[model samples]
Target: MRFTTIGAAIVDIVVARVRPVLGAKQDVDHIGLYAGGGAVNAALNMAALGGEVSIHACVGRDLEGGLIRDLLQRHHVRADIPDHTLPTGKSVVMVDESGAARAYAQRGASAWVGEQGFQGLDQADVVYVTGLSLKSQAWLEQALSSMETPTFRLVVTPGARQLSHPQALEGLWKRADLLCVNASEAARLCDESVPDADAVSVEAAESLARKLVRRPGQHVLVTLGAAGAVFFDGAQECFHAARPVTAVSTIGAGDAFASTFVHAWALGDSAQNALARATDSAAGIVQVIPANRAGLLRKL
Candidate 1:
């Protein structure tokens, strides 16, 4: 299972506490720091699951960048760190007692990845692209065009900014073999508000999956929080149920799911088996408290 993931790498500074949903200021019960970034997290997860994973992304010249690289290497992930002077990406993740989180993301060196950074894509069996590193249409086109391998599978996970540009996203969607998104992103692409306004609803997930699967050369996967996920592969549809768990933080669950799914799928697992594996992995992530969360990229 040779997999390549392209996106930003960030240090996640997480603070967890028991506080009301709305407040001016609250006391933090604990704080934890972890290597984080959409693509990096996925790459780490894939490697942890015994896949041969390589990361194609940029990091800063700062200590945070060093930390991110060290962490990936510790997880046995091959990394292609480009030279950049910008600060490494960073995120502040706050988790309430209810296991819900809000994140403030700052893209630093991640935005500097360009055509020169995408030179090694042809060596991968599967390629993953996230909206985090794709800032412009030119960058997306250049990255995709650089792939010379006819059998390379392309997986696209649109970031928040990419959701605002429907035409550009649709263009990229056509080139992707797999498209994974949350309910909000799916609704944003369709130019309509999702029914029931809940990401975990079957209606919203299935609707979004259907819309994306209709695109040429794309299989759609919609992740529904604790409800698990749904995959639409043209003529067939597959669903997996989430495992019951007491969650401590849900911040990294999506990344965990996407990476696990890709790893399983790349290994030729059926859609049902892949989804089940992904759900179990995500459930393990959500149960870990921030301060006690260690070896996040290690095999379970």
Candidate 2:
């Protein structure tokens, strides 16, 4: 199946287990640069899994953009990305000893992508959109208003920041056939006070899922990290526990799950089977630091 993903294409400078003092430089156990961003990561995952994938996120005509393009080509993923005058987007990701990651980002060229970027939407069987793409009003209209209903399978994976402002993407989610989010993002979308994945009880998470289902047949999937994920479709609901693994980094785990799930489901896997596939894929990603396309391919 052909998949098109639209959102940010960023350069991630990942640092592992480094604690810094205000004015001094510190040594790190590991530091590497990789191509990243929700859309970029998801597209690469689908490509590695043998799907024909194309990405439409904006990049700049700079070293960072060149890096992103080269990585995409090496992975066999098609790049439909356009170059911008601004620098390419970037993020500095810091991973602690516990394998948790935090990021400081500059949206850069990604922030400038608008309606013109949606020109080739009809070329794919499935169109996957990340939260980063919906921030522009013109792009949002092109995606939701200008397009026909149910032209292709629409899968949405809104990040925590987008979920924080649910009102902005309300219409888009309502129109989506599949909506994917982690426990924290789900809680935020539902206006619930879920502090973390563990704190989100299955019942509470299921309740949040029900609230997120905008239509009768729409699927709302809430992933709870190692707890796995919960799926609700207004009628049926199921919880799948994650396979156990020692995590190297939790970064991009959610993106792995979303793309894997979409790939499996599009290939005719049952919802339960798709959830299992996603959980297993995410488990592998967590075991690799950076969890970008090359790392995932290496793990494979």
Candidate 2 residue-pair clash tally? 0
As for candidate 2, its clashing pairs are: none
Measured on C-alpha atoms, candidate 1 has an lDDT of 0.76
Question: How many pairs collide in each candidate, listed in order?
Answer: 0, 0
**1-300 in candidate 1: lDDT tens per residue?**
688888778778887865875788767786767877777878877777778888877878987888878888877889987758889888888888888888888888887656354666777888888765445445757667665555788898888767777776777788889999877677777777754323457766786788766466568888877777888887667888889899888877888888888888878899999999989888988887531233432221
Q: Please give me the total number of clashing residue pairs in predicted model 1.
A: 0
lDDT of 2: 0.81
Runs of candidate 1 with Cα error greater than 4 angstroms are 21-26, 133-137, 146-149, 195-200, 214-217, 290-300
